[model samples]
Target: MSKHPGPSLAQHPMPWWRSGYLWLIIGLTLAMLAGGVVTVWLASQQPHAPVAAPPSQAEQGGSLEPAMQARNRTSSRNAKALGTGGD
Candidate 1:
């Protein structure tokens, strides 16, 4: 046999800290990834709020109705003044 001996057993044995910590790092990375996925899912899940409807006729104190009536009256009066139709 050669003069030099083979490597020591302890030198090759896995270090205690590295073994557990490597798994811990893997677990934390997985947890973060899962959390990110859940966050995106939650963000996309919500429905949008509905748009407000326009005010009803009663809310405007009959403003539009009076304007329409005035317009009709003016049209009829103009028609009579022009003598283009019934007196």
Candidate 2:
């Protein structure tokens, strides 16, 4: 039997540009690049606000009371367990 040459490139049914998948990928990539550019532009246009200074000791009055009480309670429990009476 004689061998057939099979389909040639000139006889191909559809070219690469006509593919829907290729166009979709290209569109998504362009969209992603545009989004990145917009994000960078927005960030550069708006300067960050200055960070607020930590509250001073005078400004923090009774906020630490509960924490201090918990620490004291834990220390007393440990001291009693060790028979040191928390010195």
Candidate 3:
């Protein structure tokens, strides 16, 4: 009898298309693609309204500039009165 064993034959693996893992990956990819398509279609159908600026129109128009200066002055005066103002 030969000390060496005969070469063992292993069965061939299943094709990628028949693999469950391959199908899972394909299914997930198709799902994500469908979701993206639906999202794009919904977005395209919506109104394209312009977004308005915030409610602080004074900052943009410079109308609140004087009010802000007056507030700063009042705070400085209060700080000096309370002796919390840095020299």
Candidate 1 local lDDT, 30-64, one digit each (tens): 99999999999998897679899998877966668
lDDT of each: 0.84, 0.90, 0.83
lDDT of 2: 0.90
TM-scores for all candidates: the values are: 0.38, 0.56, 0.51
Residue 8 in candidate 1 has what lDDT? Answer: 83
Show model 2 residue runs off by greater than 4 Å.
1-10, 53-66, 74-87
**In candidate 1, what residue range of length 10 has the lowest lDDT sum?**
9-18
Which pairs clash (backbone N, Cα, C closer than 3 Å) in model 2?
Answer: none
lDDT of 1 at 50: 81
The digit string of per-residue lDDT tens for model 2 on 14-71 reads: 8789999999999999999999999999989968999999987659874777878999
Across 1-87, the per-residue lDDT of candidate 3 in tens digits comes to 769765554545556688799889999999999999999999889678999878776666758778898889999988999999923
**Which ranking of candidates, highest lDDT first?**
2, 1, 3
Q: Pick the candidate with the highest TM-score.
A: 2
- The pairs that clash in candidate 1 are none
Residue 82 lDDT (model 1): 93
